[model samples]
Target: MITFILRRLATGVAMLVTISITAFVLLNLGATDTARRLVGQTASAEIVARKAAELGLDRPLGERFFEWITAALTGDLGRSWQSGQSVVDAIATRLPVTLSLTIGAVIVSAALAIALGALAAGRRGWTDRVVQVLSVIGGAIPGFLIALILVLVFAISLRWFPATGYVRPEDSLGGWLATIALPVIALSIGAIGSVAQQVRGSMIDALRHDYVRTLRARGLPHHRVVYRHVLRNAAGPALSTLGLQFIVMFGGAVIVEQVFSLPGIGQSAVAATVVGDVPFVMGIVIVTAILVVIVNLAVDLLQGWLNPKVRLS
Candidate 1:
């Protein structure tokens, strides 16, 4: 198990390095000059050149990439070209809101998926059909559309919660939760469908195995047979799929944040992109890549723990 974990961690680090390189190259490939975009259009050519030089953009591409990576490792993510503020500070300020929303969405989605999936698998009749229909509807609708509808119904008409913006949890936990409730629900809807589908499929497949049949023939209670034997065996693949779904949810939250006017990393990334704030954009990309690598590693470890056969091998 230790050896497997170490190998997977090494691979994850390599993958993150590749992601960083790709993000850096793509961000710098655009026509807009970062210095000019930051300094303003009316600035003289000489001034722009001097600013670019000061920022080390005038150096060779290899040197610039090396500098960026070195600075990142040392905890200096560079200054935002637009605001002249440290990119790290900006990210720190916005991290709480994004984390709050992401965590809430994941919790809601995971609980609902597991419950609905197990229920559908055990029932396997009209209840299963109903769940399937709901899952399809959930998968078909876009998150932004769901957010809009939720705002119209719950915020505008019902006036139950604020329609936009975020409040720090420290100020008022209730208000913070209320403001994010709609957005989290919107983000979770699609995730629930995907996770439930995977869980149900895995459960059904596990139930058909010879070991499950033997347990049933041995006069085990139906609940114990389904939950203890079948579901336990099925959990390995479901958990792996859940981790991948979480990564997808994080990426999709960007659009959901924009539509809902939530102040999150997604909104910051979009703002940076529009204004060509290279450092800020790259910072977000690097953070996202790191998160993906870490999540994948964690999932691999979890799979090994859940399935001893994998660990032993």
Candidate 2:
């Protein structure tokens, strides 16, 4: 297990390095003038040239990429060409918001998935049929649509929470949770659908295995057989699917953040890319890549732990 984990860590590092190179190649090799576009078209030619020089855009691509990667490793993600704010600091400021939204969505999705999935797996008749139908419909609808509907029903029609705006937890726990609640629900809807389907399928398969009957014949309590045996068997694939849902939610959070006027890494990335803020854009890209790689690694470790027969090394 330790060996497998070390290998995964190495793989994650390699993936991050590749992603950094790809992002840099896109930035410096693209036709856009990074400095001028970031500074604005109205800036004088002299100002553009000076800005480019100051930003090290005047250097060769190889040199610039090296410097950029070095600084990134050292926790200096460069200054935003527009705001002059450190890219790392800016992202750090927004990281909590994004994390909170994603975490909330994960919790909600996981709970819904486990419950609906187990129910559907455990029975036949209308309950199973209803869960299957709902899963299909929910999966067919995109997350942004869910966000719109939620805002309309819960925020606009009922006014249960603010339509827009975010609050820091440090200020008011209730306010902060209330602000993020709708966005979390919006992000989780599609995820719950996908995960529930996966769980239902996996659970059904696990329940049918010969060992399940053997356990049942041994007088094991139904709940014990389901929880101790069935869930552990089903969880490996469900966990992997859950990790993928996390990635999807990150993308969805970009639009949802904008819709709700919440400051988050996704929104920051969009703004940076729109303005050709190369450093900030690259910073966001690197961070996102790292996050994905770490998630995959974590999933592998978790699955391995769940089943002793599963071997990675």
TM-score of structure candidate 1: 0.94
For each of the candidates, the C-alpha root-mean-square deviation to the true structure, in angstroms, is: 1.8, 1.6
- Model 2 error, position 23 (Å): 0.7
- Candidate 2 Cα outliers beyond 4 Å, as residue runs: 43-46
Give the whole-model CA lDDT for all candidates, comma-separated.
0.84, 0.87
Best by TM-score: 2
Residues 135-185, candidate 2, lDDT per residue (tens digit)?
888888877888888889999999999989999999999999999999999
By TM-score, how accurate is candidate 2?
Answer: 0.95
Estimate the overall C-alpha local distance difference test score of candidate 1: 0.84
TM-score of each: 0.94, 0.95
lDDT for 125 (candidate 2): 83
- Residue-wise C-alpha lDDT for candidate 1, range 1-313, written one tens digit per residue: 7799888888888887898888888877742377787778888998889878877677777778898999999999999988899999999888777767777888899899988888899899999998889999998998889988999999999999888888788998898889899989988998898888888999999888899889989999988988787887788877777787778778888988888788889988887888788899888888877777777877777778778887776
Quality of model 2 by C-alpha lDDT: 0.87
